[model samples]
Structures are given as C-alpha cells and as structure tokens.
Target: MKRTDIYPMPEFFERYINLTDDVELKDAFAISLQELKQLPLDKWEAIGDKVYAPDKWTIKDILQHMIDTERILTYRALCIARGENARLPAFDEESYARHTDASNRTLEDLIDELSLVRASSLAMFNSFTEEMLQRSGLSFRGSYSVLALGFIVTGHQRWHLNIIKERYEVLG
Candidate 1:
C-alpha cells in the first residue's frame, strides 16, 4: 500500500465510524473488483437474469448501476482533485436508469461493459493520493468531502451484493 495521510474522519462519520474497517477500503475495492471479475459469464446470465423483477433491475442492471455510480463519483473526485471548486451536479438516478435501457439489454453485454467500466475506475482509484481523496466537492445534491464519500463507494457495493444474495437470490 502506498504511504499517504488519511484525512481526519468527518464529524458525520460517528454513526458509521465502526461500520467498516478503514484500513480495508482499498482492499474492499480490490475484492469487489475481483468478485465481479470471477463471476462466470453464464452464471451472471442465470443468476443475474433472474435477480430483478420484470420491470426492475436484472443482475446486469445491477452491474450497470454499480458502474454508473462509480463513474459519477470518480469524475467528481477528479474534478475536486484538479482544484475545481464548482458545486457538484445533481443527478437524477431514476431518470438515468430509465434512459439507460439497462433492463432490456442482454446480461452478457451489460457485464462486459461493466467490467470495462470497473477496470477504468479502478485504475483511476489506484492513482489517487490520500489528499486527493480528502478534497471537498460541492454540488446541488450536497457537499461531500472526497474522503467521506470514499467510504460510501467502498461499502455501497457490498451493501448491494448482500441484497442480491439475500433478496434477489431468494436464499432462506
């Protein structure tokens, strides 16, 4: 691991301070990337195809979602790291979801695209210095210091993974 200073945890983080291992954020990111990578294409088709409701997200849709979220956040992180002081743009996730047509796309196509997107984002993430992750980003949606949001990105996918296993997988 690269040696860099971790910004002081935000006051808002008290509720979540112990929820995750701060040391493992990078590791978790790596593991999620690996998990998504190791999932067999056919298995993605079978399990992912059945994961969502008729009009809801399929497994491919979930992958699309993960990639999309990463895309937006990564760009925001870049803008902040570049010394941009502009407010963050508000995003309508439901609108994006509707317009993406992810629901109708084949599971394989979405996964391939998602895999590519993840690779791109991971490369970006690896390059970030701790200071860059702590920079503040402003947006109509709200203010989020890069350091604070980093945890969200790390934990958010795991949150969804559990949902897929418990809710969508129909596990007892």
Candidate 2:
C-alpha cells in the first residue's frame, strides 16, 4: 500500500511520514533498510558514545531507540488491525534508553537486531489485508491506520538517520 492510501494521517508523526517517499509500504521499507545498511559505522564508532549536546542520546542510544520505537509502533498496528479498541499506552524512550544495555552492545549487533526487527515488521505488514490496512486504532498521540504505521516505521528511521547525519556525523 502507498502513503496515499493512509486516511487522516496522524498529526504527531507528520514530520516523520513526510520524510518518507510517496512509495508503496514495501518499497519504503526496502529503501529505509538500504539507507540504514549504508550508514558510516566507522565514523560513528570513532565518535564512541559521544552525544552532540547535553541530554542528547549517543549513537548507540539512538539506534536502540529506533528499534524500541519500531517494536512499539508495530505492536500497536497489529492490535489495531485485529480490531482491538483499547487505547495503547505511550512508551517512555528516555526510560528505555537509560535502562537498556545498549551501551555494551556493538554497533554491528544493534544493526543486526534492527535488521531482524525490520524483517519481522515487514512480514507482519505483508500479512494484513486491504481492510486490515485501513483499520484505525487510538494511540498515545492519536489514531493511526496499519498502513500509516508501516510508513511511519520507515520514515521514523529516516528521521533519526537524518539527525545522525546532520548532527552526529559532524562531531567526528
């Protein structure tokens, strides 16, 4: 399904969704994955847990955040597609980042986890029917369709990667 297929885009995630192409969900996933795999790991490693500014996340933190956020969003999509009316709880990124052992993990390992998560996400999204894709559920921010969630996953990665490029890349 294409971005255009999403009805009433979630306002809170507009910046992320806008960062993505007007392509099919599967295509968007492919492009995002490719971009992720091409990231300059050597440079990032050289930075070595440095944050560009105070209170900002390290490169590893950011990568872990991306994985965590995607998992939460994908789960919401699944619940919504299955006709669940219960409102999903919002996740605390700061808490997750602070508490996780992402610091000890190698960049390669984090990337591998991310790739596996994306693959799982793609499989889930592919299983949804047209009707399921259109299904909406209330979220922490607002209502979102399954298709929108899929695109948001791609765009959210794009958003963070852009931040890493624009901010973190300049540090080293």
Candidate 3:
C-alpha cells in the first residue's frame, strides 16, 4: 500500500512516515529484516556504554528500545487488524530504558532476542489479509491502519540504524 493510504498522519510520526519509501508492506518488511540482520554486533559491542551525548541512549539501550517499540507496534497492528477499537496507550522509552538492565546482557544476547521478536512480528503481520492490513484503529496518535503501523515499525528501525551509524559511528 502507498504511504498516502495511511490517512490522518500523526504529527509525531511524520519523521518515521517520511523515512519510509513507497513500497509494498511485505517488501518493506523483508528489506527491514535484511538491514537489521546486517547490523554488526561486534561494532555495537566495541561501542560499549558510550553515548553520543549526555543522557542519550547507549548502543545497548538503543537496541533494547528498538525491540520494545517493535513489539508494541506489532501488538497494535494485531489489535487493529482484528477490529479492536480501543485506543492504545503510549509508552515512555526513556523510562523503559532506565528500568531495563541491558548492561548485564551481551550484545549477542540482545541481538538474538531482537531477532526472535522481529520474527514474531513478521509472522503476525504476514498473517493479515489485504483487507485486514487496511483496517484502522485508534492509537496515541489518532487513527492508524495496520499497514501504516507496519511501515512505521520498519521506518522506526531505519531511523535508529541511521543514528547508530552517524552518531555512534558504527557501520555494519
């Protein structure tokens, strides 16, 4: 589906929406998965706990945040596809990162968990029919379709990956 198909674009999600190219959802998902799998784990480990700026997310925190956001977006897509009308709540990434103990975990472990979470998301999104993918629901940012959420999930990852490359200087 086209990006314009995602009506009533939420102001906050504009960056993510703009990051996405016009493409089929399945193709978008596949491209995102391949990009994610290509991220160099050794580079991420080498970065260690370094943050580009004070109070910014570290490499581990960023990875955890991506995993968390993907799960939430996937769940939202599932709910909307199933015709649920309840407005989904928003999550605080900083609070989540503060509470998460990624320091104790290895980069390999985080990558493994992220891969599993992404696989589950892919399966869930793949199960939806075209009509279901077009279904809309309320979220913190007003109305969003399942297909739009899928794009958002993909774009969100791309945004962070760009940050990893530019800010963290970690190239895959």
Which candidate tops lDDT?
A: 2
For each candidate, how many residue pairs have backbone atoms clashing (under 3 Å)?
Answer: 3, 0, 0
User: What value does the lDDT take at residue 55 in candidate 3?
Assistant: 91
Q: Show the lowest summed lDDT stretch of 10 residues, model 2.
A: 27-36
Assess candidate 3 and give its TM-score to the true structure: 0.91
How many clashing pairs in candidate 2?
Answer: 0
Question: Tens-digit lDDT track for model 2 on 1-172?
Answer: 8998788989988888998999988888888878878989999999889898999999999999999999999999999999999998998888998898889999999999999999889889889999999999998888889999999999999999999999998998
What tens digits encode model 1's per-residue C-alpha lDDT throughout 10-108?
454323323445564466467656766665555455564564455666666676787787788778767887778978786776677767777678866
The TM-score values for the models, in the order shown, are 0.74, 0.97, 0.91
C-alpha local distance difference test of each model: 0.63, 0.91, 0.83
lDDT of 3 by residue, 1-172 (tens): 6676776676777788778878877777778778877887777777888888889888888889999999989989998999898898888888888999888888778878887887788888889998998888888868878888988998898899889989997422
Q: How far is 171's C-alpha from truth in model 2 (Å)?
A: 0.8
Off by over 4 Å in 3: 2-4, 170-172
State, as a TM-score between 0 and 1, how close model 1 is to the true structure: 0.74
Model 2, residue 30: C-alpha shift (Å)? 1.3
